[model samples]
Target chain A: MFHLIKKDLIIQKHLLLLYLIMLTIFIYFQNSSVFIIVLISAIMTLNSFYYDDFFNAHKLMNALPFTRKELVSAKFIGIIVFTSATMIVFMIVSSILNGGIVLLAWQWIVFSLALAMFYGALYIPLIYKLANQNLISIFLFIYVVTAILIPSILDYINEYFPNIILFFYHLPDSQLYSLLLLISVIFYLLSWRLSIKIYEEKEL
Target chain B: MSNILEVDGLRKVYAKSQFVLKDIDFSIPYGSIVGFIGENGAGKTTTMGAILGTLKKDRGAITIFGKKVDVTKPKIREDIGVVFDDMNFSSHLNVDQLAKVMKNIYQQWDNDKYNHYIQLFSLPKKQKIAGFSRGMSMKLSIAVALSHGAKLLILDEATAGLDPVARDDILEVFIDFVKDKDHAIFLSSHITSDIEKIADELIFIKNGEIILKVNKDELLHNYAIVQCRSDTFHEINEDDVLAYITKDEMLNVLVSNKHGLPRGCQISDFTIDDITLLLMKGENNERTHS
Candidate 1:
């Protein structure tokens, strides 16, 4: 399974390089906002996996003797591995450009986690039902809509209950980090399970 | 010989009026290479997909080696290998990368055999699959299928577009596959001459229905085209005839038993193609009459 994941990553190395260059260029001129780069990086990383299967990679996955569960597991694991790598690179670049140990905001953390969770959730069903043929248009539509709606919703919430923002802002750094981490872990696991179930019923 | 694979009451009804396959039943022995012959829309590919559990069936049962198939269980797939006409390999991966990926997929994968077939087929190991020609891609697929020690192989139009040489090379590989008495193959193709060269049994399907299934030797000895006037052809009993095609003056009847043909009828050898065409026509005639 690890080898399968490694092989998949190797196949998409060029895409990764292109994404890194594009993100680096997008961040260079703008004021160093770690949140923006990290958010975009995470979304791009996750979307790469989605696009591959959405386009033409499905038959390759199916023709292998692997179970749908193994394929699903490998994909989920690949996303995690890819996302962690992308996050590390993003942090390194942001710190170099900002000239300090600039940390990610809790909002940034929450936003990234939610995006990843939602990506996996929506991608699983769409892929199972539509295959990869319509992956781009649907993924773009969802990504744009979510990108627009999420920040607006967060802003509205901040306005309605200023204390809610203060509470998250003032919570002990370690406790807040742990809570977000726990939620992220739970969402990832749930996404993995849901993807497996949907893939099992998908016609080849 | 015991049946190595059995499919009973197999049916797949798609949306609209499409019946991709309906009531398909057949069995093959442990070592037989059975040729599944049909036209473009005759559901040959669909049946193979159903047997492999890749396509959904409305209702049916498929068993291999006397064991029931559980589609959710990947272990059932370990015993079989499939090669489709279209390339299923991801274009980005090189042959070496693909081999490593496949090693983890099939527990019975033989690296030595895989490499041997790759070399034998003369496929470039370092090139991406997308860069290869159609014939090369098919050769790679055949290599992957054979690399795993699968007892049964299912090929869908595996020889459709190849030049004669490439097709012959594939045929040679298939001949070697069934050399061991424990192996069997379900080869679906429109190329009847290729089928004639390699298959031990022939299954003729037309318009989503199986019209005939018989051993190659029996089919060869029994099937004959009886040519006579269209009016005289009606004198033969419908029960004895498998299929009949009518031209302006000649009525070519495909009979299961040549011995039962009328004495005045002229008999000629029937190739697999002839049999398939006659059956297809007969099926349309049956629909027209009904």
Candidate 2:
């Protein structure tokens, strides 16, 4: 599994360099750091699938000694490794730029990690089931719907669910972090299982 | 002789397609190369895929190394090396980088052997595989397949895009691989001459069915192509005839046994290419006679 991860990373080495440059700009600008981190993480992690599809490497992989379950596990593990490494890099750069670690930097790091976990949890299973082409279409569809719905949804929540929003807003940092970690772990595990099931039956 | 791979009653059907592999059966004995000969869309690749567990078989059993295959187990695949006609490695990776990736993937990957093949095939070490010509890519694939200490090699058209010199070199490598008593190769190719040169057994498939499987020596010694008039051809027993083609008022017939052929029936020497052409282009004796 680690070998498979290494192959994915090596294939996307150029993309990683591009992500590093983008990440530096995002850190220096300090605008939408969380979003940028999540975006970079998603692209770097998903780049493996792109290379696999482009080269038809999946057929070779399936023919190798690794099982479909192991292949899926390796993808999840690669995402986690990539997200964690990028988060660490961003945190260090942010601290360096600000002269020291601060509360805002810590908050952004935690939020980015949470978002990375959520994205991996959501996308991995989708990629496994729908594969490359269909997954991209579904992502586009969701992006459009989310863009059109966010404002109205926020208004509705602010009007009728004010207390719920307040409850989260006022939650202790430790409690919020714990909640995010718990949810992330649960979603990731479920996604791994779902991906394994989907890939086992998939025809190469 | 002990068999390294055995495929029995294999069957597959693609959704919304009429093509189906019907009860395919063949075996590759240890220390021998079994050649798979077939025309396009004749289920050669499908059969190979089924044996490798890449394609789901509707019904069949594939036994490798004396045990029923369980593709979900990584250990089972550790002993098999496969090369398809289409290159499967990432184009972004160079040969050296690919070696690194393969090193981690195969437990018995021999870096020395890989480098040797690289030198032997004259492939550029630093150039990305995307820039490689078809023959170069094919050589790289074969090199990777051989570097791993796989006891069985399954190759589909591994020599498709090579010059005669390069093809000869690769064929020699295959011969060297199976020199050990425990190693074997199952290869499919349109180049019947290559098969004729190295194969110990030959399997002919047509339209998703195995029409003939015979030892190479037996095939060469027992099978004869007889040229005669249509009247004399009709007199020959249909059971002894395999396939025939009629041209210019002469019938060229492929017969399994040449002994006691009718008088004036011209028995001629036949090559693997000749047999392949007849098997593919000519009508089966049963069909024609009926």
Candidate 3:
């Protein structure tokens, strides 16, 4: 499983570099905060789910002595690695830019945990069902539409229900972040288990 | 020696209205090269996939090394080496990296054997698999498959795109693999000639069903093409014959038994390809309700 993950990273090293360079350029030009930069890197880094075996490397993985369970586990663990590494890289770059880690220590913890859970919740089952190709297309389409609709929906709710917004805003940021992180983790585990079940019965 | 691999009543059906495999059954004795011959979409890969536990079977059972194989069980893959037409290695990793990776995956992986086959096959050790030619990649695959000391080699169209020389080299390697009677090979190919030169048993598949399982020597000796005038073709009954096609004045018949040729019929030996064509014809006619 370690070998499988390592191989994936090796294959996608170029893509990783491209993503980092693009984000660095965006950050340099836009004067984006470290949080925003981390968010972008988190999104881009999740593309590893779609691109690592973009050329059908699973064919080779299936041929190996490892069972399908191990292979699927490797893929899930690879996501974890990607998310963690992206966060580390994000922190290093952020620190370099601000001459210090501008992200509050607690915020960094919550953000990293949220990012991992968020991507895992969405990407795992998608890859398990349709694999990289169809999942990538569907994810992109949903992400784009949802990106637009989410803000407008939030603005609408804030405008129409000021009392509810005020009540939620009064909660400590730490508590709110933790709540979201808990929800995300639950979603992530659910997706992971669902993926495992689906992949177990899948025909290679 | 006992049969190395036995499949009984194997069947697979996809959701999209067709059975990919229907009641497939065959057994390969240890060291025998069983040639799996079929048309392009004739369930060869599906059957192999089931045996490897990569695909679920609708109904069937497989036994390897005299133990009932549980498809979901671990380590069944340890004794088998599989090669598919499509290359699966990461493009960025060169041969050295692949070697390290495979070494960890296959418990019995022999570096000496891998290096030996690499040199014998003239594979570049430093080059990335992405840069490999089709033949070179296949050679590399064969090397990896062989390195792990697999008792059974299951190949799915691995020789499809190779030039004659490369094909011959691979054939020779297969011959070497079966030199020890403990080893067995189940090789799937549309190319009949490759099977003719090497296979001990030939299994014919058509439209997702097993048409015939034949011993290679017996198949070659017992079957023949009999040509007769169209007028006399009616004298031959269906039971004694396998299949035949009539063209104008000539009736070309493929018979199962060469000893019982129809009166005034001229008999000639049939190649493996000819037998497969006749089987296809028989299957097609059966399917059409003719």
Candidate 4:
């Protein structure tokens, strides 16, 4: 299972420098480190999925000794791995550029994890289902829309839907975050199980 | 002789299409190469997919290494190497990187052995697999299959698109693979000549059904195509006629027992290709011999 997780890193070894460069650009523009964290995690996660789709690596891996459950588990866990690793990289890069450890609040880290979990949970099963339909391109397309349109949608919500934001603000911060984390965990686990079922039923 | 792989009553039905694997059955004995021959869309790939567990068998029992196989299990798959036509490792990685990926997935991956095959095939270590030509890609795929300490190699059209020289070299590797009594090969290809060259046994599949399985040498020596007229054809035992095609005044008959034919029948020297064409194009009398 470690090997399967490492597989995503191995395939994307050549792209690491480019990903770092993108990170550096985001930092240069002084984008919120939270935005950079979520975006990088999404990119890293989607980058692996993109390569899998490009080479039909799921079929290749299935043909190998790896099981469908292992494959799906690796992707879900790999997101955590890559996201954590990126956070570490972000810290190192920030310190190298600023001559000190410039860290985001602990809340950003938790939010990044929750957001990435949500993204992976939603996409992994869709990727499996789309693999059957051979509509994998839509995955990247959706990624583009989410990357470009999601922030705008959030911005729109903040500007036009103040009462919704006020309702969340009035709620106990601890309880709201705890509830969000619980929902994300349940949804992530459910997606993992769904992906395995879809993959098992698939005729690769 | 003990068999390395045995597939019985294996069937796959595509709900979106009418194609069905009609209780297909065959086996690859240890120390021998079994060639699966069929035309395109004749369920060759589908049958292979089913055996390898890529395609789910609707109804069947597959035994590999004397145990019921769940190809999903990593332990059994560790002993079985697979090579599928136009399907392989990620094209993005170089040959050297590919070895690293395999080493992690397979417990018994041999670096020295992989290097040996790379050297044997003259594959560049630093070059990415995406740059490989059809022959080079095929050689690379075979090299990977052989390097992983596999006891049974199942290949689907492993040498389909290569030049004659490339095909011969690959065929030589296959012949050498089964040198150990513990090793076996079950390769599917439409190229009958390749089968004729290296196969110890042949299993022909048509429209998802296995039509014939015979010893290669026995097929060459005993199977005969006889051209006889209506009177002589009537005299030829119906049991002897494996398949027949009518051409004008002559009944081109393929028979398993060449000596059993009547005197008026004219015997023709035939190749495995001829037998395959006759069997595929003509009517099958029985499953012949398994």
What is candidate 1's TM-score for chain A? 0.73
Give the DockQ (C-alpha) for candidate 3. Answer: 0.42
Error of 4 at A154 (Å): 5.4
Clashes per model (N, Cα, C within 3 A)? 1, 0, 0, 0
- List residue ranges in candidate 2 displaced over 4 A: A99-110, A134-156, B285-290
lDDT of 1 by residue, B135-164 (tens): 788788888889888889989878877789
Q: How much lDDT does candidate 4 score?
A: 0.83
RMSD of each: 3.9, 3.0, 3.9, 2.1
Where does candidate 2 clash, by residue pair?
none
**Predictions in order: lDDT:** 0.74, 0.84, 0.75, 0.83
- What TM value does model 1 have? 0.86
Q: For each candidate, give the TM-score of chain B.
A: 0.93, 0.96, 0.93, 0.96
How high is the TM-score of chain A in model 3? Answer: 0.79
Q: Which stretches of candidate 4 lie over 4 Å from their true place?
A: A132-163, A171-173
| Interface root-mean-square deviation, each candidate | 2.8, 1.3, 2.4, 1.6
- Candidate 3 residues B92-141, lDDT tens each? 66777778868777778899999999998888888887898877888888
Query: Individual DockQ of the candidates?
Result: 0.42, 0.69, 0.42, 0.66
TM-score of each: 0.86, 0.92, 0.86, 0.94
Proportion of true contacts reproduced by candidate 4: 0.64
